[model samples]
Target: MGDRFEKLQDRLRDWTKADLPGEIWHSVDLFDQDDYDILVVPSFSVDQQVGEKIEGFLHYEERLLFSLIRLRNPHTRVIYVTALPLCPIVIDYYLQLLPGIPFSHARERLLPISLYDGSLKPLSKKILERPRLVDKIRRALRPNKAYMVCYNCTELERKLSLELDIPLLAASPDLLHWGSKSGSREIFAECNIPFPDGSFTVTSTEELLEELYELWLRQPDLKRIVVKLNEGFSGEGNALLDLRPILDYAPDKCERVETINALDKQLQNLSCQAEGETWESFSKRIPKLGAIVEAFIEGEVKRSPSVQGYIRPTKEVEILSTHDQILGGADGQVYMGCHFPADAAYRLKLQDLGLKVGEALAARGAMERYSVDFITVQHPETNEWDIQAIEINLRKGGTTHPFMTLKLLTNGNFDYDTGLFLSQQDQEKHYIATDNLQKEQYRGLLPNDLMDIIAEKRLHFDSSSRTGSVFHLMGALSEFGKLGLTSIGNSMEEAEEIYERVEAVLDEETKNYGDRASSLPLNWDKA
Candidate 1:
């Protein structure tokens, strides 16, 4: 890959806003004073969406940052924004997601995003090669001396930099070093951070079975364990170990008297996957692809968790923590949108430990924004709270990045010392919808055309055009499906009303668009 990129740089001339294949929100706040020393640009999607998956990694943000610094202000100094890291733990957590209460028209009503109708993802044969993209980026920047495009590279970043003559910001400088589950465990031990008790870190399949046997010995009653890969992301890289894999070898793992069929039935209840589902529909799409399984703890406290922290440029832990639910999971869940100061009640419990984790990274000399996850549990006997660290994402999270973009356009003074982003003008936010579009469908829309659609306050399809009048989800019901959404409202009632309206609009649009199959994500402004 590195060799490929190096070869390409000699031929390409990167320019500003060279129309790329995938969706990009190359946005800038019209209201920003243009005063900040370093401006971090948002990146392109990690991979270009192929069929069902967006394969490979490329630092789209790095390409943008390099170009921006040279053109925007090369000598001044800047840091390219990094992409958020996802939990490999939940990647492919469940094969089939059980529909929530309103299962009626929910499937029928969804806007074709989830309906698996042998609709093969028409991924480009030309994947977004990072090295090639970097070559294009170098042509755009023409920088005299390279500084750094900040991010934790995972194959994608390395080639992009080597090809472009750009310095890769080793996230070793940021908490990206803490991306390892083991590193997270250590942060917990060294600082007494609260989190799940991980018994072991198994690397190979044998070690995995040995640990499982040991866990059974230590707590023989424990039946299932949650296994995840150290390098996995989103919900694509994980599995829940049942008796089946070992059933063929060690019948003991499956009770001989109860028989393998009985063991299969039991494991079946753990997931929604049916025996008939296709390979694409299977959970843990790529098995034998490395995993990290731990004791599966069952509990009543199902609410999600988050805690935001920042390591300053000076390398200090001086930031407040904010938290939220991982709102969108298999059940129509996307990452997060809602955020609030860590609840007052849990403050004291998480504060010291949160700081300890932040400081640990700072001591390692990586200073930037990062967030951690944990589940707060009440002791079975004492009813006491124990907030445990799930893992640390070494880069900016979904909540932090978009909000900062809003901050640039708002009237608030962002106190970097204190993680509080003061809402400037009664809060106006961009309702960003990062959805995948069949490139063919989006045949004529331009960046401005999409913005124009948004500006019109129309949330349904234009009957004549056969495209999105506004294809957004019913904010209320969105959370039930995998690609969920929640309206962040000042009042819950208003949020409810918004959700209702979003649904009403969808119903009407569905009736209208069903009559005609329109080209999606049409780059209308393109020539």
Candidate 2:
């Protein structure tokens, strides 16, 4: 079955190469004046166990609602599939954001299909399991003018692509290794990029311990180390091991055999980034999913910055945007949100380094979007920043939708020279976005209730000024009290202010609700 699917995928790839012009396939160019059908399968086809840990993970499908803006072209049709039906109010809200398009006209071109299954399986798998659903999708697409886009391409997505007989606008699943934690380290080495000192990929506890011991030997002064699952996402599969607890076993204090023994016992003390995670359960996954250990770059002042770019079908690498990510967890490793264009100090440097990685991935036949994360530390006295490459995400990530929303809303283009996004009106744009605006107080607020708040407070993005708020994950609001939004402004300060205003408004609106739970601290301030 796998071999047959691969052959079909090969044919689909050949079809895409023969029929589509490279320029037309650019992400931003979805609005190009070409007739095509876009099958938006925003499936987070990751390890189910890891994915289940996230609250309302299925609602993430709404992140790609920005794709609806493609309807502004008048010739493009989008068929969005999800695990469950989307709220009509949520769909209407997105359509209303289309600049000059009429609501009814855009609605006519959009098809939102739901499997009505809320199971904890990947949406792609759900579709593959239902032949009727697969046929419905196939019938909705134009014979040769359609392609599928997904959150991440996995074996499931590839199989779905074959079932639908359409090309997937993502990297081939066979090349997914290049996106893994260990594979990312290898790419950094091949490109001569600076990443933390780490061990090769290990698939068993013994192998992991061996690698950790070698890493300690290389960086004896290292205070901490990060253990990452090769296929982790959003840092959930990461754990921090504080070496201070076992300093007595240091190379200087004890013999190699003694140090190894101490390290083995200390492994149980790993502080996992994922909620409710334990070293025992985490280590158990080592054999199923490979893991790696790297010296944790430490500094008094550090920033988590990331660069997003695209690997064009033509093998051209295009840098899309850069952002300073807002992270929050027990040890500040989880992804929370981001400020666009990163910091001026090193935004350009990020672009240069990101292009290097993109070029390398392109050479390896990687396609579509790819993002690289980095840890930048400031020198207290010299004020110089030291940047270290972290890992590569070969998929549409947290920053993808927000940046795409900005482009689709204002028809902006990212100015690589300045690392700023410029609107069609030539005005500069900035935004702060997050998918973690969750609060127990926000639970039970139906889609209509949220829209009423948006209307009363004028929280919607302003078409005239091209600065305001655009919300996503509306489906998660009623059930999980979680929502996502991108607050755009002419400047960084303005963007932050807008986001703060939204936070304040939501707090005020929900403050009177009974049995109120303490609000989770908004981590935007950390950015």
Candidate 3:
């Protein structure tokens, strides 16, 4: 099956490069075509190092991206495949947001297929394990014009594409390294982009120690360093090493054995990427996963911003959006949310850097979407910002869906010069979004209950006003006390206002219910 999949991918590669009659190419170009088929496989096909239980919860949020179906061309057919079926209520909630399209009209062109499995495995993996589902998908495809859209491309996704004999509108698995931390660093170097001082990729603790010690020798003033996995998602594969204590040790006392032991203890005590993940557990997995040790760039006015871009099939680079990422967690490394258009002061600067890197990626055959994360700080003397490229994500991410939703909802365009999202009416748009709004007290609420609350509070988006709140990840609320929110506004202040109001309303509505009732389990147990 693997060999067959590989062979199919080779043919698809050739298909992508060759012109086909009356066929539109690429996911972004789907709007141009009146007839096409889209197979959306929202799979988190990263290395299996990240535990399955967490992966299952993550899937809850990704289902929101399928809201893309709401923007479907009337002649287009969209089949959304999930590892577990989505709640019917969740499906209706998304469909209701379609502008001029009737709910039934969109539904007629839509297909929701599921494996009915809630394991931590990738959705593509689940689909692969079930030949019946594969055949169903094959039968549903729209012949030669069909393409698979995924959360991320991997060998599993590659194989799945072969099984269906459809081209994947994502970077090939072979090109994924361009999105990894190590790969990002290499690209930064190739493109002459400024990046944090970091050591090359290391596979074992010994190699990590060697890199860190070497970096320390070059810059003894380095106080902290970040150790990251090549494929860490949302900072779960990252750990910060406090180098102060180790650096303070006497030169005479720095025996190789003592140094390694001290560093080992420090690594063990360092933070783990996910909840319940211990250094002991994470450290054991580092050797097999590979890592990079880099000096942690710090400053008083530091901010993390990211630039998202897309490479068209014709090798043109399109700068889609920029974001001021909201980071949380002990070290402020985890992805919490983001503000659109980034900060006006440095938005264009970030865009320039993003294009330089994106053009390099386009030249390298990276297709579809990719984003670059950056760390910027204000210099005390000159008040100028110093920016360092941190990493790149070669797939859809936390920032993807909200921007996509806004664009689809309003048929807007992001202006490169002004750093503003302009709607069809030419009004400036802004939004505040987060995937981490979890409260232990809100555990017992059901999807229906939340929708009722939203209605009663007038929280539904108003097409006329082009402003309101949209909820996602409602499936995780009862069990995980988690829900995703995106509050859109005409200005930054307005967006923040909506987000604050929504939070207050949710708190008030669910206040009593959280303490009194047990959350109702969905059809299946959450991992």
User: Residue by residue across 108-150, what tens digits does model 3's lDDT show?
Assistant: 8878887778777777888899898899889988777677888
What are the models' TM-scores? Answer: 0.57, 0.94, 0.91
Better of 2 and 3 by lDDT: 2
Clashing pairs in model 3, backbone N/Cα/C closer than 3 A = none
Among these predicted structures, which one has the highest TM-score?
2
Q: lDDT of each structure?
A: 0.40, 0.88, 0.79
Model 2 bad stretches (over 4 Å): 1-22, 27-30, 514-527
Weakest 10 consecutive residues, lDDT, candidate 3? Answer: 24-33
If both were scored by TM-score, which would come out higher, candidate 1 or candidate 2? Answer: 2
Worst 10 residues of 1 by lDDT: 90-99
> Could you give candidate 2's per-residue lDDT for residues 1-527 as a string of tens digits?
56765555454446546556654555334354556798999998887778877898889988988878788878889999989899998999888888788999999999989899998898999889999888888998887678888999998998888888887888888889999998999999999999999987899988887888889988889899899998987889999998998998987788878888888898899999888889998998989889999999999999999999887676788998999999999999999999998999999999999999999999988888999999999999999999999999999999999998888878778899999989887899999999999999999998988887898899988888999999999999999999999999999999999999999999999998666543434564684
lDDT of model number 3: 0.79
TM-score of 2: 0.94
